[model samples]
Target: MSKSQVEVNRFKVKAQLMQLESDPIAVEEPLQISLVQNNKSEIFSLTMRTPGHDKELVYGLLFSEGIIENSDDVERLESQLHEGERQINQQEVILAEDISIEWSRFGRSYASYSGCGLCGKTSLQALELKQSRALKPIKSKIDNGLIRRLKALLAEQPLFSQTGGVHAAGLVYEKQGELILSKTPFFEDVGRHNALDKLIGHELLANDLNQAGLLLLSGRIGFELVQKAIMAGYSTIVALGAPSNLAIQAANQFNVALIGFAKDQSFNLYTADKNKVVCREPLD
Candidate 1:
């Protein structure tokens, strides 16, 4: 066993030296996804990730892309770190009967980072094939109370309060009047999209997506988060920060209640048609 070497940078500000460790400096790791087919051997696709949750992350990546629909499609998994290479050994899936998959689509070279969700090839086609479900409109209204609670909860995240480097997604539980606490089931990532994906992957395994509860992010609501949230059946999304223009547009098209800038009892509602947000304002 040995200490993992990390990078630390030094800078100066106001005649002072500042040193910080940029947490998630990328380490090249392999995402070995294997689907054992009957003909002769197993097939695999190697991908690069920030590491951790290699298994469920792989499953979620495959499932969300329509590459592997269920757990049954997984053959077997093995992993090892040798010569500084994270080698994942995969066993080919051999079912009791015949199975068919368009194996050609599993290449990671063609997959874009989840944060940068749109590429010419996977855009419209994925929307049609995967997240085609009509999102339910927001039936209840969110008041100033909700916005205040969201920002407070987001600020309370101990990780970002320290590192300022990770992303988080949690289900908010509103209890006694004006009191809210979030249930954190997943909190680990350099990307918001990965945090959401990891949470959704765990929930899907447990058959719990309807409770698609409130999402409090450390940063702005980007297009991919909006898209993934809608696809996962969460009609309402609240971010402690702002919302990108494309994020708002996607939420409107998908019928998701897009709420942003959730701080100091203020929030911007992007989809009034779906959210019970004020249709008109006193600011007028």
Candidate 2:
């Protein structure tokens, strides 16, 4: 079994009988993250996440939190593994010597659960102040058909198919008039935010965030998820579920094309810069 899930024996209760069966449960574990700079290390976050692609998770977290502008700002990442075990519960991020961090903006350290995305923020005002400039408008328009196709791809998620408890995030990039889902840019996690972070982190490391891509989420779009997408320079976002009010507002503020409730035939476009995303006309 993959480390992302664990096999458990549980009682399956039905209308008439109870049977014991082996099921796959998504694994959730605490990962303590520390930032190292100037020979000083400080633990800033403790997040519950699935046990895999930890390096991408850290990169995504740092990027979303505005700790690092790019992958170059992070010198190296060191995993603290338990003795005699391959499981890692801690990670140390070494920043480049020239990098400077504004701790005041970071607010306080807190534990982030798998279900909550904005757990440690001090206030909405502070979060608003940290918003970066609006993303550059994309030259290509996303086809509604392509947006609908994303839902069908969910069956490809390995972890979600097994546990049905994890969220997934994927990036579909526009290349030479074709929308292609990059092989390595999709990630699944117990947390929606962590899934997006892993996807963004992988692109950040590859220096591919500049590509015109659509961010796809298997779950609802919250304000935090939209904020992360903006920070990562995504201009278009499509989700399989609904979007929160705050999420719509943030997307508008950043001029992001946010689409939600992506079904097999229809989806809601909450906010869009017409120049960036153009939808096809309705059929008679």
Candidate 3:
């Protein structure tokens, strides 16, 4: 488990303007997840992910992809960071052989997720999730003022704020018009999907999965992201940018409320019900 760590940053020049001793942060690291089973071999995603939470990342990946259904289905998840050298322990996952994963298709590279990318897939014969009918009403409503403030807060968390090179996601809660964040945590990755996978890992570890709030992304909403929202049980998903067609499609299918282009005094609600703030015209 010692090798199960990675060096995310290295000493490099700042803006190529000055070579520093401390090293700029390395936000991404390679993680090779080993899949083991009888007959078929374990294929890896070769995901270029952020350091830490590698175990949860693998669990989320497998669960979200329909590879495994519940915790009982999973035997155990473990890692070894490239044999040694203080890098992410790059994990070797052991799952029941009834589950098969084909890594060749993953292309030994980073894979981004669209919460619903599987909606159109035709050949993934695997165990389906045992989730019940979504209990919340289709619509989700939030105070107009909180929506505005959350938008502002979502724009602030990235560690790469100075570099503008990372994507971020956070679980946010609203109580009495005040926005409260989960002690869980947030993540910033070179890829938006990766950032979310990290966030999911954090949420799972903290066991703060009430699923009573919204997921705020600093990027656009996509099918893969929508899938995460569903798996995470988040009722509302808000993005600071436009949403993709597939993302909207999945949101509708899963009954999760979706909001996009959330900035300033504007936002659009997609496929959700319950809480909303309709703006009334100001009196002259």
Write candidate 3's Cα lDDT for 47-138 as tens digits: 54446677788888878866678766667766564643356545766787576555555544333333212222221121123233353332
Candidate 2 steric clashes: 0
Question: How accurate locally is residue 46 in candidate 1, as Cα lDDT from 0 to 100?
Answer: 42
TM-score of each: 0.51, 0.55, 0.51
Evaluated against the true structure, the overall lDDT of model 2 is 0.72
- Residue-wise lDDT of candidate 1 within 185-251, one digit each (tens)? 6465787877788877876787766553555566667666777777777777877665654466676
Stretches of candidate 3 off by over 4 Å are: 1-140, 174-178, 181-184, 280-284
Top lDDT model? 2
Q: Who is ahead in TM-score, 2 or 3?
A: 2
- As a whole number from 0 to 100, the lDDT of residue 124 in candidate 1 is 21
TM-score result, candidate 3: 0.51
